[model samples]
Target: MRHTLTLFVTLTVFWLLNSGHNTVLMTLLGLVSIIFVLYVAHKMDVVDHESQPVHLSLKFPGYFLWLLKELVLANISVVKSIWLGNSTISPCLMTIKSSQKTDLGIVIYANSITITPGTVSVDLIGDRITVHSLFKENIEFLKAGEMDRRVTELES
Candidate 1:
């Protein structure tokens, strides 16, 4: 019930924000759209925690900020490597154990690694994730476990 309400409210807010119309017609249309979506979601039986993820609302902002900072640092590192030529690059494919217990947490961590400029999540097998990094430094950054800890916190 709570998840359903959360999903409804979230979808409605998104509709209003994205629609950018405050008139009666737009408001009514948005309300109808939200109701139709809720109806379909109810029929689909996906109005659950995995679908809505309301629990992640508060934690995700901080994680996003941290990830943005990491991306900037990674971008700088990549540019520096380019300027210094390919000699500075030491590409490696390695597997690391996932500290997250939930599939959502592991996915967020993997996507975060993949989007961070110099590293990509190649595969996830069981609790281990295979990562390909453009430099040894990027691998060391992942091995430090800071992003893993932050993502685990977001999920839990």
Candidate 2:
């Protein structure tokens, strides 16, 4: 029931912000669309915790800020490597272990790896993830487990 309410409010806000139409007709249309979406989602049984993820809301901002910082640092590292030529690149394919207890947490860890400029998550199975990185240091960074720890904390 709470999830449904949250979804409804989220959809309404999203529609209002994106549509940017204040007229009655537009408002009615948006409401209709939101209702249709809610009905379909209820039927599909996807409007649960995984879909809404309200549990992660409190920790998400901190994780996002960390991710943003990592993104900038990775961009700089990649650019520096490019300027220094291929000789400075040490590409590696390695498998790393993840400690996250949920599918969402594992996915967040894998996606975080893929999002950072120098690394790509190639595969994820159970608690293990295989990654390909432009720089060996990127793989080492994953091995260090700070991002994995943070994502685990987010899920907790």
Candidate 3:
């Protein structure tokens, strides 16, 4: 019941914030839609309580700052390599270990890796992730385990 209420409230807030125009009827309609969604979710039994860990807390601001810095650095490196006009990009496949204990955490970590520039997660099995990096330096960074460590910390 708590999860359902949380989902409904989240959806309602998202709709209200995103809507350009405000109207009493529209707000009531949005609330109704949110309730309908919750009803459907309840009927489907797709909301796994086990997946929502109560103790999990992420330092989102720090993670976002770190991610932004890494993105900027990656963009600079890619631009430099492109301007050099040589085959400076070295593609390599490497495996990294994931320290996240939950399946959802592992999925998030893998997806985050794929979302970042210069690297792609090709496969994930158990705690191992196969990543394809555009450069050997990127592979080395992964092997250094900094990314994995940060993701594990976030998962916790």
Task: Please name the candidate that would achieve the greatest lDDT relative to the true structure.
Answer: 2
Candidate 1's error at 84, in angstroms?
3.2
TM-score of each model, paired residue for residue: 0.89, 0.96, 0.86
Candidate 1 vs. true structure, TM-score? 0.89
Give the candidate number with the greatest TM-score. Answer: 2
Assess the local accuracy of residue 59 in candidate 3 as a C-alpha lDDT between 0 and 100: 71
- Write model 2 residue lDDT over 9-83, tens digit each, in one string: 999999989998899999999999999999999999999888888999999999999999999999999999999
**What tens-digit string does per-residue lDDT give for candidate 1 at 52-152?**
88789888888898899989999999999999998999999999988999888888888999999999999999889999999988888789988888888
Each prediction's RMSD to truth: 1.7, 1.0, 2.3
Clash tally for model 3: 0
- Of the candidates numbered 2 and 3, which has the greater TM-score value? 2
After superposing candidate 1, which stretches have Cα over 4 Å from the reference?
Answer: none
Error of 3 at 145 (Å): 0.8
Worst 10 residues of 3 by lDDT: 49-58
Give the Å error, residue 130, model 2. Answer: 0.2
